[model samples]
Target: MQVAILDDWEDAAARFLAWNDLPASVDVTVFRDHVPDEQELVERLRPFDAVMVMRERTPLPAEVLTRLPNLRLLVSSGGRNASIDMDAATQQGVAVCSVPSPRMSDSVAELTFGLMLSLARGIPQQERGLRSGEWGGTVGISLSGKTIGLLGLGKIGGRVASIAQVFGMRVLAWSERLTDERAEEAGARRVGLEECVRESDFVSIHLRLSDRTKGLLGASLLGLMKPTAYLVNTSRAPIIDTSALADALAERRIAGAALDVFETEPIPTDDPLLALDSGTVLTPHVGYVLDTTYEDFFTGYGEILRAWVEGSPIDALNPEALSRGPGDVRDGDEDRE
Candidate 1:
């Protein structure tokens, strides 16, 4: 079976995982760069019977999904991928499978705190000053007894909230699905979104990206933040309006902002956010790129391919696609039946 892996930008798929151990029947191909054009992506992927993708790097919209006729199974690194059009995949009879990575949250949660601490203590600024043969010239904010607003009480957010409590920071959390009981368990007080933003000394985002969450934090909401407060987002980029964030930081509407994700991957060299030299910290979305996470992800990839080749697909997100048959395997193969 022909398998294609897209957006292995680090070229880590072959080196970091056990791809050589995959059954000889599986012909695996990994694309180390992202193909931005939908038509180009479709043309490149048309020959493959299955495709594995990095989260949200290359979008599989309905139009793109309809063009890949040979595709039978799709797998993504994490259990939830906002990039794939699930309804389109289901309609096209394409089985989708995802590997669950609970520890992935641990990686993201750690980065979220790292950014917050960096912003609060001005660590980066101090390090740069020392390199220039200077001492501290700027005052840093203290985390203890400070109020931290958590935008979501999901796995990553809950972890952050617990850590905030350990630091003696008051945690206020808000999410549509977050229960009061759950917030109490996480040592966070449940509050309205606006109240959380308005009252926080530091605001951290940990919500999933979806239609309702896209541009959830616009200029109006950001404008509500205190001029002394800082913002950190290790979650999806579109959750906060990029233009609004750039404007807020450029004008010093907020004290500072740190981001690990962006609306576009490998942020454009000319992106407005990059021009601001002060009060901003940026990373290339390294939240879930740990060695352990990659091992968990690729091991699941190998297992999925093995199961499909053995004619009993596992971890299917779209089970109906399996009813169509075990994908377009080699002709007259006994195992295919």
Candidate 2:
């Protein structure tokens, strides 16, 4: 069976995650660069029996997925991927499974603090001034007495709250469905959205994307925030409207923002946000990138491919495909579950 790994941007697919579970007989190919369109993806992967995808890199739409008749398994790096159309995979008789994700909050939470400290200390600007022999160029704020607001008290939020305590900063949290128990566990006080936004010196967003969270922070919510405060998003970008954010940043409606994710990734070099000087900090979609995680991610991907060739697929995305049987989807009961 042929196995293909798509969108290995760092060229880490084969080096980090391959060979652990792959069968010697199977041929595995890795594509290091991203293919921009569906046609290229379909043609490149049409011959493979299994495919490994990076998170949200290839948005296997219903049309794009239907073209791959031989594809029996789809493995994504993260356990949860919004890009894949699970229903479409079920219709195509494909088994989509995800790799187990290790706890990834530490790296992102640390980066968040780095950005916060940079902003508070004027690190970026001072570094530039220092190169030109300037001294005491910029003044900055301190985190000692600041109020930090967490938008969601989930895995990453809990970690951030702990770190905030170490800094002697007050921590508050808010989410539509976040429980009071979860907030207390994180050492955060439960506050309404407006209160969290209005009072926080650093507002960090950690919510997952869904109907309720999509476009949750925008013109209305942002307007409620203090102009002296900073907003940090290590979460999905669409959770805040791209245009509204750009407008706020342009008008200096808010002090600054630090972003790790964007509404559209690779976020075109010419994007308006890129032209802003006061965004505080920016990073590509690399909140989850780490050397250690890749080893486990790719190894698991290879396992799913080898299992499919043996007629005993595991961790299928569309479990219903298991009930339809081989050569058809009748035996794809494992997929439905």
Candidate 3:
């Protein structure tokens, strides 16, 4: 079967993943760059029997899914991908699967601390100054004795809260799913949305992107932040309104903002956030792009393909597709538990 790997920006899928361990019957192709245009993407993907996609980099809407007649299976690196149209895949008789990486949450939590420290201490600015024969320009604050407000206390947010506690920083958290008992376990105090935004010295976002959270931090919530406070987001970009953030930074309403993800990947060059010098720090969405994560990705593919050949698909999101019994469709079931 012909297999295509989409949006391999780092070109590490074949090199780092255990692709060679798979049976030689599967022929794989990798696309290193992103194709934003829908028609172009549809045409490029038409020839593959199965395709593995990077997390949210390339969207698979119903329109694109219907155009690819040969596609039988779809695999995503992460377990939850809002970008994919699961309903469309099921209607088109495409089986969707996802793999989880144990280390992805920890890695993202670590980078959150790194971004917070960089913003608090002006490390990047000082490094740039030293390169040009200049000394320190302004005083920087320390994380110890400061307050960090977390938008969610999930696995990644809980990890951040624990680390902040060890640094002597007080942690506050609020989420739709976070209970008072869970907050206490993470060493965080449960607070209201306004209180979390208003009282924090550094506000970090860690919530999942959903209907309720699409614009959770809009102009009104962002306006509640202190003028001296900093904001950090390693989660989905749309969680915070892009225009509101740009206005806050441009007007000096907030001290600064650091982000790893954006509403638009490979952010447009003319984005207003890019024009700011010291008030913004941006990264190209490297939160879960570690080597360990890649290993899990390829290893999952190998296991998934093996299961497919044996007529028992595992971790399949769309089991109904197998019922069609189209061509080589299997009859067994081992869905994720």
What TM-score against the true fold does each predicted structure earn?
0.91, 0.91, 0.94
Which regions of candidate 3 are displaced past 4 Å? 325-337
Clashing pairs in 3: none
Q: How accurate locally is residue 225 in candidate 2, as Cα lDDT from 0 to 100?
A: 81
Q: Tell me the deviation in Å of residue 62 in model 3.
A: 0.3
lDDT of each: 0.86, 0.80, 0.86
Q: Candidate 1, clashing residue pairs?
A: none
Which 10 residues in a row give candidate 3 its minimum summed lDDT?
328-337
Q: Report the C-alpha lDDT of model 1 over 80-172, residue by residue, as the tens digit.
A: 787899877877778999987768888888888889888987888889999999977688878999999999888888889888988899999
Per-residue alpha-carbon lDDT of model 2 for 229-307, expressed as tens digits?
8888888888888889888989999999988888677788888888887646887877777776676687777677667
Model 3 global lDDT (CA atoms, 0 to 1): 0.86
Model 2 poorest ten-residue lDDT run: 328-337
Count of backbone clashes, every candidate in sequence: 0, 24, 0
lDDT of 3 by residue, 51-85 (tens): 98988899999889888889888988878887999
Q: In candidate 1, how many Å is residue 184 off?
A: 0.8
